[model samples]
Target: MTTSSSDSTSAAASQPGRFRVGVQKFGSFLSGMIMPNIPALIAWGIVTAVVVNVSEFTEAGWEPTNALAGVIFPMIHYLLPILIAMQGGRLIYETRGAVVGAVAAVGVIVGSDHIIDQFNAALPAGEDQLGYVHMFIGAMLMGPLSAWLMKKLDAVWEGKIKPGFEMLVNMFSAGILGFLLLAVGFFVMAPPINWLMAALGTGVEWLIDNSLLPLTSVLIEPAKVFFLNNAINHGVLTPLGTQQADAQGSSILFLLEANPGPGLGLLLAFSVFGVGAAKATAPGAALIHFVGGIHEVYFPYVLMKPALLLAMVAGGMTGVTTNMLLGVGLQAPAAPGSIIAVYVQSLGGGVGNVVGVTFGWVLSAGVTFAVAAVILLSSRKRDMELGDQFSAAIAKTEAAKGKSSSALASLSAGVPSAAADRIRTIYFACDAGMGSSAMGASVLRNKLSAAGISDVYVTNKAISSLPGDADLVITQQTLTERARPKEPQAIHVSVNNFMNAPEYDEVVELVQQSGDDQAVAAGSEAPASSAEHASGTRTAVEPRVLTQDRIRIRAGSATQEEALREAQEILVSAGAVTGDYLQAMRDREATASTYMGSGLAIPHGTNEAKSSIKSSALSVVRYDGGVDWAGDQVRFVVGIAGVGDEHLQLLARIAELFSDESKVAQLEAAASEAELHALLSGVNDN
Candidate 1:
């Protein structure tokens, strides 16, 4: 939600020690398992809302019954926890651990009590033995602990157990341990754990009854901004709220942390009263945050203006107070805070609850919008400057760190063999496909539209469901590992920030370059001459030397000689020039450094060294980490391994590309070799 880098470990790693990083990674792992199941949680919420609130006709007359509860309650109290435990176990120690994790979770379920005395009150005296244990919390704890314990056991038993008896030993060990843990949970821990939960639930109920629950937003609003909303809601609030729901009819905690009204209000304010790009982006963010139920979309907006935090707190307090005063609370958690999901979850509270939540939503939105508008209007000049600074920061991130190559030889001779045409569809992937990735896709889609680029299709997908034909895959740095293996052939681009505008702009330019290349191929029905290319520099030099494989986009060389040698390797591999050409180039560089202005450094051998060249050729290398060319900081290194006057025309084309700083920046940020080759192919076609 905040504007910090999205790597799961970044916040933890930013702390002063290794302990913090380890804790962060562990927390992130658990979060990964939990966040993907929000849809499942919503379904469970719907079931709870309907089963508890709705009644149907019976044989005698229309009456209420808990029959429908039997169908889904077991899933909430048992199956879901086991599933969560299995997932956590698998994540920690693979299949063996997963099996053991589910077994161990059963112990927690058997020991923990879900209904306790609440069931006695619902039933006639002495006949109230019916009670179910909600094992979600216990399952979360026991699953990982059991997996870790089993892992240790396996390590100790390794090579000791006979090969023939290994399976028997493994199965008996898990079974015995699980039985022992179950006994301990049931005999010694269940009562105390259930008591603690009951106490917490009681505190929440007291707050609601006393009409002091609105004050809880002072803590809840800030926690949500820091990405702790999921942990708070699912781990603490939901379980407590569910226990209360079982006792009474509903719990106010369900609506406390999940009210999307505050975010919706802030976005409405930004859309109406904000200035520049922030204002333009707010309307789309408002739609996503409100109807789509992704409250995260507005967090960065608040973070950008810290004063707007007061607005969020005010909105949250207003919403909670309104719901409390109306005596309305949801039967279950309304995940994602989406309006539709909230309405479904409010079924347990009947018409009053629905009206109350709706009014609260409007009230919070109105308060947040009014407060935020005043903040923006009062600091218009400062807000505009900060907006520009944010954009600049994004641009710097997109430009990464690399030196641009000075090798013209690869561009002319290697001649992008085949990689240019392969990439067409670009995918933006995230942990959950529905939230961040969708917003990223929309951003890029709009950018492409503005650039008048129609052929390229930009879309979003979950990391697991990545498509086969995705020519390029974009994901946050942490989740890139998941997206890469699924589409190994696709060009992978990882960024720390998905919402950064400059990152989207870079991707758009790349797609545009590819489109231009496609147009070039279509218009000519053949590879056009150098003059007919997009950059408008005609060249007589052969295109064979500048193959796709020879063009290195975003190479990480630290110096001029290193860049030149890298370029030489590409040329030699392509059979365009001899390896000894590197030496010849060095001798020429010793005479005078080839540091050209406009972030270009043209490195080449003297005329005398034409004997070392296989033929007249050029190699184009873009270095994102600017290399030191004698005294100049060079970004592009065009390696000239060509012989005689034939290479002169190619130099002209290189000069033309170097002259335009904007185009040079785009080339420097190119995500793949194909994109770079496409840009080169379009050089004179423009």
Candidate 2:
């Protein structure tokens, strides 16, 4: 997992040079023949056998039988190699060692044939006999011989050999080592496999000659009707995995040992005949099919275009048949549905191995390629029409989540598309106008200006003194109270450290969409309360009756008078200077400052008991800013007086908000009433 991207790139760059071009392709084809299911090849191979045996049947189904058989099987033969190369290249990427092993297995088959040919040439002309025993000897042992030889070569190259590809290097490590192993393998295993292959071949020939020829038409006809190649590759085989081996019995063992799906077969076929133009999309498709560990990737591509499907199916069936024909069987399952596990199973020579496997893959790839090419060319128009659907399907994923959100869905003409324009704004507000009021405004203005949005501005003047238009409105909860009815078009932008984050952009997009949706619904519902009557000002959003008897000023313990005085100063510096008006407060204090203990307080006047604030709200101000509290530094303050009992629940949220340690710090250190206001409206309260 600790992969350095640089290293992986370099390694991948050097990978192709390891194998000569065609070797990997031909190797994949030959090795697959020894693995599991191959649908396409079975389709065509059955046809081929039937065609050669047609004259023997009393009824050949007229020329259609011969014509179909001729047309299908031959087509498969031409495209098989393309299918092989594609799948083989993928294997090379994941584990080169396994690939080398598979290629060596191919050599075994070739070596076995080579040995037999040498023997036949040596036989005296008059007595020469091409018999079942001769071929069986060569075929039976070829698989293991190839495997063991590959192992031996790998060993010698690692032990005695060194770097072979660099300039001045021997370059003889695996090659020379393999040649030696090849010689020893041919001597030890070829004779027996040759005889075995010959015997199996003859047996199959006799079956076709005597009984199969007559039934070939009937069997293939029904096969084509109800269960073509896909049924074998996808239908019966893939479902077998949900029933993965759990026990030690032969059934489970077989399930594990055999290749489990036909996914690889289909992918191979796509690569084969999907046309040069289609390959642009095909490589990504093939990789997903190969490594995503899903077999369904290629199904639709094949279904819409059978030529591709046939190429895969033919290669698959051919590989399967050859494996069985060669007596190669899996000991456990492997992905890419290849027979690499047979060595682990040590399931040497059987009724469905070498001959079955080798032949199956060849036929499967070839047939699949042929079918895919035909279907692709036929459906060219349909592909064009449905092209956009593919992108839509992929867009909803995490990989495309940003893509969809970023895509300009319905930008208005010349009205600055989201893609074209990035909107930014800064709101400036202060109560009455002075010290910290100007400080908070200065900080925001400088930050936004540094970001190149100097067009934005913030101010501390009363609404009466201020201009009517602007973009954003940053003010204290109390200041917003004094400033009313201006810049109705401005956005309530959140003031935070990250106007630069991805999430910020996402939030902006959401706000934009929400604005649009709200605009459409605006015709039905009128705007809520205006600035004077703005019920939803930051927090405590509820329909205020604006009834009488709601006190405005918040006070804490008399023991903390010093802390209150400092908080008063901070709030005052921020332009929220208290105007008591004062003497009215002194006259009322004879009764109480509303310091209702347990760290709570409410200070108010007799005359302005119904002191109207925009919100019938709750406020908690800590006097760490300084308060004269009977020598105690009052740590928390709650100013509350509700017109009705309904507003009591609002105190609960206010208490919870004040209880948080982070909120306490911000409240305690507030530079001005307006800074406290901005903090709440921008985040803490929200």
Candidate 3:
């Protein structure tokens, strides 16, 4: 988020008349908008109480209360963490799997705790075991995995499984997921979690004890308001919940389990400074701060003020450092937090742990705010200067969007539809009309614009509702498999990365092979209504060399520019010109050159503009020596294409040609035209 605000207001105006930033706010805000994780959070909460409180309630006289605590605590203990995890997933994934990831927090906690317990038991001299430190270490990893697992599971259950059977299918599907999840959590995550918790706990516990106690009133009180107030557990701490961590000042550590991490400084800066920095992300940031209590929004500010990073770094150290000095301890897991939990932990510190981290946060924030404010002001001035330039550019682009949306709805990779057949369309299908398909649509929108490709990309659920000649489903690999229609005139090909990863190669492949591969990618042996994989069924026709073919390409100087021009002209001469069809070459070149940077340049683009496989043209341009492309001198230009208008056999020839980099290299080095032609002839098109 950048530092630019539309409204200037009071800092103390809790009315959000200003703004706020920080991690707790961002995490919670994001996690909340995402799917609700109530079920998974509930399940994980059950696990935490059972495991953490099981030993505490084993007493004789206190058995009932302890047992009761055991039952309720784990479930509640899990809530904050689950919330934290779901928030983390939302920030990182932002696509469909956010709420669904709540289940993973359970596994992260369970697996990490078991491993940490083993280590705590092993520490020498019988020092009291550290608090639930394993949770923090595991929390980081949970977000990414939760995102992947949720996305993966979502794909399998909703995409591949038959409709009406979704619920039943998901039951078995979730089981498989659960088993795999448990296994990875146990074997893969456990060892690392144990080591990290041990490491982090060593420092974190020290902070909770001597350091946090002395500064409570200052740090904990304000932090409670600023951080995760929901986790403070204000009532539960009055009487110690049964846990060995209660013996000393350990309860302070227990409360940290539920409280939000430090975030006030970040919130203040983002709300004030980064006003218009990230418009889309800002609303989410605001929600996370106000309600969700995720404090990670501070991260982006940290990203901005890298020069003044020491302030935050110093603040965190002070938080951990002061806790160490205060000599407080806690038994409960460090949850994402609620206000009640923070209060109890502060109370548990007996005035010491509360005081230390308390002052530390203030001193930290005061120093951090000052630093962040200065940076924000500086950036604001810079932004203001750039505004006029940016505005004009935006307006120019905006005016150009004339009929772009309609054009998108009428996109075709081939030559703009013949004047007689003016309509060309593309459809995007996915399980949930809102999730992967939506993401794919966004990506394809960008791709189509860049490649000069226009096609109507529509979501699946919305597909049946509309009326049109639209078919040729563009969707995830699995959805096509699961939604197999009985009398399938609609043909589908596997799309990955929401169409972004399909990139030039995959997109061209999907376009050219659209109707033919409905089953093979599904791993279908061949359903009764099946068609062979598109690539395998095309008729092979001999490729005719149109120009007695002695092609020569060279990059003597200004490599990329020269290579691009030469290659484009060659392709155009070879019947491949269709309104800047060379755009892919431009796209890849701009993002990253295909020069491989090793005395070579491989310029390529989709030949979907053609009806025949006319993409089988190889113009080998060997510079006398080389040209500067990136850092290397490109000696060869390996032009590649996916053309369908040429002949069916040419597609196989092109694929075969690309497979042997060695042959391409040999051709690149060839001094004589005959040698390069011989090298191209070596690969037979079947």
Candidate 4:
């Protein structure tokens, strides 16, 4: 399938402007540093909640001097900041970068503490002492900066170190550089960051005092549609909110951006007064946004008719004003802005606090719904005449977010009715051929297999490698535009999450019905049952490719790269491939993700590295905690070195086994390597 050059060019020209893209990227980066550390923050919040009134627990025979109270200060003052720095550093330079970044962060932390103490001592008699300044801002700055510098330094000495002395040189060089960065952070970074945080806090206090904080919704609501919500919430608000929470036990700053009220109101309005696809999908979208806490679901509705943004802003202001008037706030950041999370965080303040927070969100949601309903009703006639703009708005939302989300895919317009019969080959396309696309392909393939549909072939590829003959092309929403030009004749489906999307079920239903219709038209017998159509013959031969030694169970957790290396090492030891195949495997992953879904990942070398293979073989390892495969959980890693089509039969058998939910659970719960190997070998029986 193909599109005309003119149509493709026009579509490209209509993409979100450069400035919006830049802002979204910056916001994503900022949130990236904080998002990974949220679990730690949550842990701290829990501890704080428990110790807020330790005296209350004494009635239950709890000791007054409960040592658990000590965990509160160290976690916020030291552990969290360092973890954020290490994560930021890891993003820039991996492990070595993380080490250096941590060293630099410590310097700033200690320097700030010392400064605070000195200021307290110098104050006039009986004056209030300044609170300790947490160095989160300093950590965010120094972590990445130090790692980048270390990366540059390492680049300069690349290939210069003698083979045997490499370790010594590398260690000393990193140590010396880390020492220098530590001193630099203490002297240069801490003071400015401390001052900046103080100024920002003062500004926020002024706004609250002047009753102008609600006006921030004008900026926040619009920025959220552009996908800047994370940057504003985590990057700017979380840090400030944490400080206020530390001093006063709660902070309204956390409620400002994390409120789900505005998004709920907007989605409700669409459900009640919208037209066409927008109206049809709104009710479900509202469930996801308000209950599932995925606010991105409602972004396209606003984009479809931008005038609706006024309703969002009004709702935001109402929520803020209500919370402010009630003097209610959360003890911690309410991530995803879910009502459930907000209530959980409000628990420490007792029932009155909970009621106030609840009332605030309800009032905000009501106002937003009222305003949006009016706007939608006023434009209903014009909207109906103008036709459905939901699809275009979805595209714009994807463009702004810079990725396709499975959440949005559920709400996207369905595949054209006619395309169902034409879809014989379904290709899941992504930037790299490895990750979500492979997972989506595997999932759809399993469905087809179970449905007794043998004619359809499901596969995955990088967008650049998509074949023109593709009958159906599935991609993340962000990549749909790029994919259309490559296979314009094929039906294009955009999804945010590939593992589980409602669209996949709709596609399956369509294909099955289409097959039934074709059978009726030909006056032939109905299609065979699922059991009758299942492929592969039961084999008596013992498996040579999967041996007991090649299987590992309960392997400890490791990063994606580490797990990949371990898989390749097993293959190398078996003489299936040369050591160089590891790099080729990495190159293949770099080109596209290799995640096959269902808690499995198959990492293999690229076509160009075929010469490195000595024989066909497979290495399997089970990670108890699961490997983080490009943000997806992969419990089983299978490293492959195939010679021609020799491994295809094995792969098919494995895929078939994983397709069964009960079998996947068994694999995860396997007690030993031999037990795991026995389950894997059983694939040949089918």
Top-TM-score structure, candidate number:
4
Candidate achieving the largest lDDT: 4
lDDT of 3 by residue, 1-686 (tens): 00111233354653431122233334334434322443443343344434444444455434554556554445434655566565565544432234444556577677766766787889997687755532433444565576667545554433356658866765565556656665676578767776654554455446444545334334433333333332222212211222224334254444332333334554465557654443224344434533444443333434333543544444444454444455444434333433333443354344555565456455545655566667667777775565422212221221121101111111122212111122123445543232233334434444444554333232223233223333444544333323224113333334433423333343443444433322123112322211111213334344443232526744344435456667776766776444364555554443333443234455655223233324555455667666655434566665544433222233234333433467556666676777666666533334
Q: What are the per-residue Cα lDDT tens digits for candidate 4 across 1-686?
A: 11122244454564655556667766776787898888888888888877765546566534543677778889999999999899888777667788999999999988888888889999999999999988888888889899889878976775468869977987898899999999988887878888989999999999999999999999999998988777788777888998888888888898998888888888888888999889889999988887888888899999888998999999999999988988888888887667888898887776777898988888888999999999999999999999887866775676567555677767764623444455566778866544456556666767765777756656667788887866678876546656777885766666645665566776687567565443222102212321122222223323667788988875578777678778888998888898788778877765545665678888888767879989878899999978777567889898887775445446656766676789889988889998898899864453
Candidate number that wins on lDDT, 2 or 3: 3
Q: Which of the two, 1 or 3, has more lDDT?
A: 1
Prediction 2 global C-alpha lDDT? 0.35
lDDT of 2 by residue, 414-505 (tens): 12222212123333433222222223343333343344433322333333444644334444322332332343333222221111212223
Cα distance off (Å), candidate 1, residue 665: 36
Which portions of model 2 miss their true places by more than 4 Å?
Answer: 1-262, 275-278, 303-328, 335-363, 378-684
lDDT of 1 by residue, 1-686 (tens): 00123234354544533442343345556665555555666666666666655553234322334665675767677777788787776655556666777887777677665335555567776684745557666666767777778767776765478759967997899888777766665666567666676677678768877878888888889766645455666667876776666556677788888788999999899888887655767787788777877776666566667788899999999999888888777776676678887887787677887899899899998998999899989998886666533232222222111111111111112222123355466777754343345445545555665787655656666676776656777776555545555675665566544443344554565565563555322112322431232223245556664667667766565655468767787777767677667766766565334554577665666545556778755677777777766545777777766553344344444544554578777777789879889888743332
Question: Given candidate 1, what's the lDDT at residue 136?
Answer: 65
Comparing 1 with 4 on lDDT, the higher-scoring candidate is 4
The positional error of residue 385 in candidate 2, measured at the CA in angstroms, is 8.5
Q: Estimate each model's TM-score.
A: 0.55, 0.25, 0.33, 0.74
Stretches of candidate 1 above 4 Å error? Answer: 1-30, 36-43, 52-66, 113-133, 159-161, 385-686
TM-score of 3: 0.33
C-alpha lDDT score of every prediction, in listed order:
0.63, 0.35, 0.43, 0.77
Q: Which ranges in model 3 have alpha carbons more than 4 Å from their true place?
A: 1-67, 76-170, 180-189, 202-323, 327-357, 365-686
